[model samples]
Target: MIRRINDIVAKHIQGNLITYFFVILFFMTGISSGAFMSKALTDFQNKELIVYLKNFFSIVDSKAINNLAILKQSLLNNFQTGIIIWILGVTVIGIPLILLIIGLRGFIIGFTVGFFVKQMGFKGVIFSLVSILPQNILIVPCTVFIGVLGISFSLMLIKNKTRKNTRYSIVNQFFLYSTIIAMIHIIIVVGCLIEAYISPFFIKYISTYM
Candidate 1:
């Protein structure tokens, strides 16, 4: 089973190497930009962020987090992102938007980690690991995959548009695209559950000691 899965992943990667390369490069560029932005924060803004982080830690230590609320919000945010990417895949003109979404996700993550580490050093790194890393482990990959697929699909549509008679059935291609995206949605759901349920416990525990 593991080998089968590995083979499947390898084949997919081989098929989309160029797309993945561009998508990943774009994501990394966003991350770099976000990290730069974090460093560019004014002293007042830095202090404000520090205060906010401390307040958040206090809340976690006090066990005041509403898990259900977190879950609902996480689901809403993740699902909306997924749906947008899925829709954009179908709209060839939305290629830029799809890349922007992916880049924005990377930027957010980069800023968060950059700010944490820059302000708090090692402790901040530990805090980020517990609080931010869990869900993002899945989320980051999902965003990248979605970007690659969206771009690839959009390119395919563009190619088809220029053709006198397309070789593949658009309906069948769309169904496959939709199906893959639906599976990604399931992964996103799991990631949200981890964010809402599992990460909190780790954050709460670390908050007390940190």
Candidate 2:
């Protein structure tokens, strides 16, 4: 079972390598954009965010776990939304549209992380990880699957890859990809639930010094 699971993961990693690179590239681009944007808006938003954080910390004597939970839940929600958007993009405008959407989402993430990191220093990294990483664990896989599936489908459409068999191969691939995406969605939902209900307290505790 272990070997089988490893093989599956390895296949996924190989198949989705391009998508992964795209995600990373998009993230870096977004970070750059966000840095510039943050410089303009930091004066206002930073103070506001800090004030809010202070107030939040002040109120909760024991909110560490609760804070982490909230952060986790937010991440999960964001991931699920991304997946839904990807599916919609594929259904409405096909693979090109789906890739576009995924790329835009990646950029947004990068921008947000970059902005925060620039503004907050090391603390920003912690904040970003807490805010983004939980759901991202689920999201990266789903996005890769979506991207790979989109590219595969687009090629099939363009090349008439299955003219003789009516493209059953492509259809089968789509079904498999959709199934995997759905499973990822379920995992994200579960993670969100745990984060929302349990993470806040832990977060509050850890962030006290920050």
Estimate every model's Cα lDDT from 0 to 1. Answer: 0.86, 0.62
TM-score of each: 0.93, 0.68
Give each model's clash number: 0, 20
State which candidate has the highest lDDT: 1
Error of 2 at 167 (Å): 5.0
Which is the leading candidate under TM-score?
1
* Candidate 2 residue 2 C-alpha distance from true site, Å: 2.8
Kindly list the per-residue Cα lDDT of model 2 for residues 1-210, writing each as its tens digit.
999988998996797677567655654554466556656664778789668766766766453345455656566655655566545534524655555566666666766777668656888788778766765676565565556555554555556643676667757766776676667667666656545654554455556666
Candidate 2 lDDT trough over 10 residues, lowest sum: 84-93
lDDT by residue (1-210, candidate 1, tens digit) is: 999988987998899999898888878888888888999999999999989988888777876779899999999998888888888988879888987888888788889889988998898899889889999899889878877888888888998987775655877888898888889888888899999999998888888876
Q: Which segments of candidate 2 are over 4 A away from where they belong? A: 59-76, 79-93, 115-119, 161-164
